[model samples]
Target: MYGAVLADGMGLGKTFQTIASLYSLLTKGINGQPTCRKPLILCPTSLVQNWGKELKLWLGERVVPVVVDDTRADHVKKSFQEFRAFGHGGKPKVLVMSYPCFRMHKAEVYRMGLDVVMCDEAHFLKNGEAQITQAVAGLASAKRRLLMSGTPIQNDLSEFHAVFDLACPGLLGDLKAFNKTYEGPIQRGRDADATEKQVTLGLERMEQLMKLCNKFMLRRTSTVLKALLPAKVEQVMVLEALLKGIKASEPTDKVVLVSNYTEALDVLGGMCASHGWPALRLDGSCSVKQRQALVDTFNSPEHPSFVLLLSSKAGGVGLNIIGANRLVLFDPDWNPANDLQAMARVWREGQRKRVWIYRLLIAGSIEEKVLQRQLAKQGLSKALVDDVGQQVRTFSRDELRSLFRVDPTTPCDTHQAIKCSCSGSLQDLDSCKERAAAAAAAAAEGAGSGAEQQGVLGWAHLARALDSPDPTWQAVSDFVRNNFVTYIFSDHVIGETQHCL
Candidate 1:
């Protein structure tokens, strides 16, 4: 329970902060006990070398680090034994390992107790049932534990509960109690059927939980570094430009083009191939070795590759690709963290040029709704560190419909432009609540035309259904027909096929 989550946003020097704290703790034992304690760092395979490099840059010879080798079982055992042997004497030791290695040899790790256990990119264990989460949670022998992630809660509150349970176990109670106490009411409160009183109670519970969680989590965004960091200009590259296969007009700058789906990567790859652009592609299909090699090549000035085609899931975590100053989000992701992390690859510490982020999205397409969802999610996370006593904003059914109000006549370039701006303080919570209440009331009354209502509510219902734990095709179809057919798609399309749903 002594551990806390350092969830500072990307490009905010989480590694430096962590290293500084560890150096202080290991050098001067807690309460002046003069204890020589060994700590272990668990991170993604892609980040193992990065951790080693950062430790050397920050701490130098003050603390020796042993990077666990997973080439062979014997080699791993030998390295762990040597690491443990250092606990008796010599400079203090810290073991650096990838999650895969830790999962494979968790029993051995438990036997060799640790002073502190730091899990980097901790959101990887957001699935409580995952083997990695189970393994990490089983490390009860560690005296202190820290879970670090820029995005600790990715998709929902359940994921948040998983990481919070790791950092501060039993604080939120078990998963079932947490859902009953907080999640259920909050979710139901978002529905159009919920009463005003129910909504108010749900909002109160959510605020209480956020305030309680914020106490143990230290979060800061790039807003604090606005003056120090160069400008990051974001623009919308319309579907037209993307279909035509746009290229960087400048010759010196390297480009990192990302997509959430691999199909898009393949399409982009074809475009790059047609243009004879020197490029490297990475996705879930690539091995760990291949990914590291591709990253190294992309970062090397000697390489001719200027375009790096990467899938968001593969490149979103623990990557430092500052060699590239330009980024193109070929497609938007439901989880904004993926896009944010991809952008950070180029806009981080070693970057010298003014960063350019082009987010390609079609007007009135699914991407527009996704953008709205991303904004809502961003607002939720921002509320955590915002000053207390301010009203917190949460999504409602009608508000979700409003997100789909994109003008279909306009081209995406003019309609979907994303301007670069510095972060500001949260809006008055009371005003947000009033707006949401009004919108929810409007939605409940079915005030809009059948077409408008269908277009709006159809997408919102689809989003809600997708997020449900046990979504049924039949239920989803009935929802659309009952709520959207008269306003949006006519009965012809709605009743045309059962498989479409």
Candidate 2:
């Protein structure tokens, strides 16, 4: 019963590592029996071919895997039969399938005695009640299960419970027991107003949970790849004016502008058109063939396109737009995991240039709230996964009271809550979550450039702007100085540090 969750940082090669594991384990038998491990891989529709490719690339002729994604039912059944009756001559039998494909044909293949189940992009099962989760759960006979996700846990512990439940059934007890035990107390302890006792209890429970999970889990960050990766600088700014500033670094440089909404991408596309930047786009409207063609065109390196407009939801997961070294997350998402997944589309294994990430946010608005929630969620994730405990502040309703309340005169609500004003001076720019409320009376009016000024202090592009730097950096600086950027500041440069859980 080897169950594990390989929750490594993206570009750290979780797939390669898992393939190595599969190569080793599939060659052996369980309990001294002649039968080898029968493994089934379930992933997003986009990653089905990727899983097959990785298997071939890694295992080569040593393991021939049958990929069953044909839309035709008879064809799919034939592939399933071949995969099921696959003699253990080629190590153990392997079948690669998309989540939907597996669900559609589970009844025909569930009785095939699948011993090992690997789910890539496992976050798709974050909703415990989703039909996907139930479908994956149908493999009750799988003794060894693996859930692989670079960005696994998202907003709440409930979602964490959902994914972990699929990987290791009773590891956290049933959902109710898990909530009452670890989720309830740890969450109460993380609140801004939690008492000392509650905080201590939360720390203890978090430590206990990680200690238990570590026995069956492994996580590593991009720090391990520090020598291989070039330096990365991430900055944050605001809307349309921000879009107008982006320019390709060189003839080879490419930019990808991502937004969570297709309508938003339409607006951004219009903005790019007005600026005279050559651009291509991919969203829900595009067919699968069209989407891949666009991705290939964008990643052509010598392609004349200056920008690629991406709908975050449509193009986020399992994509490698490595031709672009710079990315702008035009807006925020309720789940930081989605944003993280989109951000990884650029700065990947093939990227040679120093990567730049820019996340846009509106001051004192729902988008700002999303950024705040991202920080809090990352904090909770760190506490759960790392050896050290962090200051936890999961999202709550009290903070949502200031949905649009703007007090331009205060410090970052994030800084004040974390009690670390040192991130940047709060005077120049302020209006994060901590100071989010004031909607009733003596407020509703204003919001910083100390944070505005200092956060970007040593950034090469803007710092050396006088000598003719990136036009985008200079424009962004001017925008911030004039108070055009209402909110700014994120965790830090991603790859240079440990970003996980």
Best by lDDT: 2
The list of candidate 2 runs beyond 4 A from truth reads 28-37, 85-93, 238-249, 289-293, 392-397, 406-472, 475-483, 486-501
Give one digit per residue, the lDDT tens place, for model 2 in 12-69.
Answer: 7888888887766776444444334678888887766667777888888788788875
Give lDDT tens digits, candidate 1, residues 106-167: 88888887768889999888999999999998988775778888887667668878888888
Candidate 1: clashing residue pairs, number: 2
Residue pairs with clashing backbones, model 1:
450-487, 451-487
TM-score per prediction, in order, is 0.73, 0.81
lDDT of each: 0.66, 0.68
